[model samples]
Target: MQFANQTGGNDFTLQGLLNSADTSVPLFFAFLCIFLVTISGNVIILTVVTMDRSLQTPMYFFLSNLSFLEIWYTMTIVPKLLANLIIKSNNISFSGCMAQLFFFVTFGATECYLLLVMAYDRYLAICKPLYYSSLMDTSTCLQLVAGSWVTGVLTGLIPVLFISHLNFCASRHVNHFYCDIPPLLELSCSNIYLTEISIFILSLVVLFSCLLLTLVSYVFIVNSILQIKSNSSRNRTFSTCGAHLTVVLIYYGTMIFMYVRPHSSYSSDLKKFISVFYTVVTPGLNPIIYSLRNKEVKMSVKKIAHRVLPSGFKKTQKNVKSIF
Candidate 1:
């Protein structure tokens, strides 16, 4: 529970964001702000989608799920990073490291599958408008979301099982901000050829496979857009898909680069830099990207702002009148 610096026989030390004392305070505040904003943005999305009945469709449904995922996904890593930065200690126990690794992979793989499902939902709506309702009904959406979470849990478990059992005699210090596969593998004294191969294949399946399917869905989506006669309609459709596409490209691009390669080829500095993207930057950007680019979301947000702002202003005005 405590982010201690002392390492025992099985404990490993994480090399947090930076080593310089000068940067620690600034970095802590910076990360704290990012964490707060990310949480607030995602929470607002969840609130808007849940409260606004008009926004309760398949698209918003998946989006709410994504917001939920982003919340915990960031929670799994950012809090620890914040702790490490402020505490000025990077030590994590063997069990603690494995737990972190497990949850990180779970949320990560879940995001991959969830993104795929979101793409598929868009595909159904755009490509098969008439059948979209019947095809992606409430039950179907729930099943897809549930499956994504379950699949992510299973995907995360495998690598953790293998890596946890590995002998970490070479070094007790991990070279990155968190307990990641490549850094852990680098520390192992045992033969890690099999472990690396297993991770590579899993990445191919979870990360690359989902990405390929998402791209294919977009292919169909693009074709559907081109066939539409109204320029405005076409632009509207593009705007809808554009936000999801942007998220897909950024999430998958960073993920594939981070996971799909051989562990031996990983550069410590590069790994840390890229880790910041998926871990902090992408999650922070998701709600903003979706809300700003999405008309329905924007409208709902406006409605909420209208209701809440007026009530608060009225209360403030009453307080000012009483003071006078």
Candidate 2:
């Protein structure tokens, strides 16, 4: 009956909170606070982007999609993580594991590609300012953004299929918190030759392709920055990308820490820590990133806040309807 101990069978055990260090009430509270912040922050971003007409450009359009993706991304992992932190013994059903794996892979891959797309947008804006609008038209933008989502989702399904095909004979105790590829692959009882190769190829595709794209965009952006005639012009251009660059540093730095390297060097705790940055912190920070440097987002947020502020603040509907 015990799957963790079963030999060449599908019996697998998920890891528990206590299995990791510092499984306590305070840790649970910390995670809970993070979840609340992530949800609220991303929602605010979506609202601000949706409400603002000035922000209706291809860049903000992609950002809104990203914000939506972030909300779902957090939803996929955080609730279960919160539950696991509170539950004495954390266990997930086979189907639950598969579902978690599916969304996690999909969203993680989507975020990576989305970031790359944003980089490319910045590159165009900087390297070819005159043609930026023409090149990054609405339909083209939609194609890139929508393509990233569908591609990530479809590729994500392949891994889940392989995971389902695996005959799990050995210990099913996933060392990491969530349903991750490496830990799941480690538990497979069947000879995973095809799965292994498929994952390797796909990982290389997702990891290297996006990373190279981002890097190339930055290379061109830097070249563009240097060629600007005036200091103020350069500063203005750099400022536009500053927040996004900060985010890219944090997101890609952490991602490359695990994904860009050989898998054998991986540490579970290290992986968990870095994954938390992209999966948990990135959502909360994204709203902050897009809103902080952006005047349109700020003005829109102020208007939205004015509209939504609790009953005591406003007289009401007569004059304000026109401004919105």
Candidate 3:
């Protein structure tokens, strides 16, 4: 396969979701809608958490950070994806591809750490209720959030540095929507044994380590909940974790399937679908999941809605005055 412009240039042509022009318009609109929803949902979550004093707790603080990460994560890939759907030539500059790979990995890994942190926060809240407040104070929460970002950036940087030195000889078509490590590695002309091993090891260290911590935290959380005498009390405590658990299941489920396995086993089409689901779909669904399931978030949304809608607030006030 004669790679396009392989003489001296490093430009890559992305073989996006569907190569046919007939499907482009529909796919473009579909992804456009997904992008808008992803942006709007995460933005609202971030806005509501920032504006509402009621949501000024450790849980929501972590949530806001997650929202912030999701927004950037979606932006890193989806816009380019949408463009690829519409445009025939999905040529991305070498530097642009590297930048995309960097941010995509950064946000993706950051989310892993953030989710783990959120799990630990939930564990502390449920298992150690008496000390939850003192232990997860504002400073501590900030530190955790900061640590996740730092860790993600560092972890993501390692792979990018290794991949940068790789030589791509002929085939420049990346068989995915984004610059994922596996596909990028597949395109390398250099002997990728060390690179593949390094990526696998790094992925295991980052993804599985976080997964283990999250599981351990939840195990203790479940144990503590089981000891509760009142069913209502146990249910209420469990409800607080319901949203995070749902997100973790979706996020980790797609991620582990994509990254945890050997690159040789990855079917290009299947990996593309999975990537879209996690990168595009999950971020959009996260705010919806939290808002629908978490009563606290729902209540906060209503409170903000009331504050925003004058007519509704007036009617509510009139009802209250009549009752008085």
Candidate 4:
């Protein structure tokens, strides 16, 4: 159903990554590959973590949560994007747009909180090793995960609910691949001062606050690592935290630049590229970044492969021998 726009309609058209017919097929295949990798990688992480008793620690638990989140996070936008590319019609109903905005924001914010929780987990593990198990018990881990989801939902709801009521009498064409806060605000004909202010405040509170907490945790972590007299211990500690730090830099760098700025400052083309980076590229890279560099994850994957492959190979050999 169409909502009222400038021309008195509810349907909004998304201006996807590229509009040329020549590029559509290539873009579709490219994104399809990325999407598949994103899903499969995350699924592998989840499966490995769940199956292996060795991966049942606080660290792997959070890594599994992140992998699970990335699956949904990528799902929210990439399918529609793939559809838009093939069909060449970017029209999304008002309800669909709002729904997309809701889930996208929810997952993104939830990730921020989850990353912070992970940082704290690492801090406890490194800085206060003796009490790590006691402090980050099963109950605490569950609560932190629960809190991140709840906070993400609540935070995401505020902007969408507010934006949904605004009059989009200016235009129905959104200049990005997805329904994001800045693009939606740009479409509003109504006075957006209060809305912008609210969003800015929320950004500072939600995004910056979590970033600050993560930084503080890392500070303590670094200090603890420096205190270790053994070079091997120091190297080991750096290796463990390095993956998370790499992810943090990439995710936060794009996100903060996109969301924390004034709506007027948005350059549609630049924002679109940045949006693609965070939404599409980052999700696919997360599992690789976290797993390829991680010895534990690599070990877990090898163990699972051995467990599953050898039995299947034996059965196949038995069938071949019987046939011969």
Return the top candidate by lDDT.
4
What is the RMSD of candidate 4?
A: 5.0
Q: Residue by residue across 74-117, what tens digits does model 1's lDDT show?
A: 99899889988888678888889998999999999999999899
- Evaluated at residue 26, the lDDT of candidate 3 is 94
Question: Tens digit of lDDT per residue, candidate 2, span 1-324?
Answer: 223422223434557434645655787788788788777767767777787787888888888888888889999988877777777546676777888989998998898889898888878877888999999998899899989999889978988988787766435678766887877877776777788778778877787788878988988898879898899988877776677778877877776665544356766776777778877777777876765446676667667767787463354332333323
**Candidate 2 lDDT trough over 10 residues, lowest sum:** 1-10
Clash pairs, model 2 backbone: 8-169, 9-168, 9-169
TM-score of each: 0.89, 0.85, 0.89, 0.90
The whole-model lDDT of each prediction reads 0.85, 0.76, 0.82, 0.85
- Model 2 TM-score? 0.85
Best by TM-score: 4
lDDT of 4 at 87: 86
The TM-score of candidate 1 is: 0.89
Candidate 3, residues 1-324, lDDT tens digits: the string is 344343365688889987678988998998899889778777877878888898888988998898889889999999888888876658987778888989988999999999899889989988898999999998999999999999999988988899888888577888888788888888887888888888888888888899889989988998998899999988887776666677788888888888776655656888888888888888888776655356676666667767888669867655434422
Candidate 3 TM-score, true structure as reference:
0.89
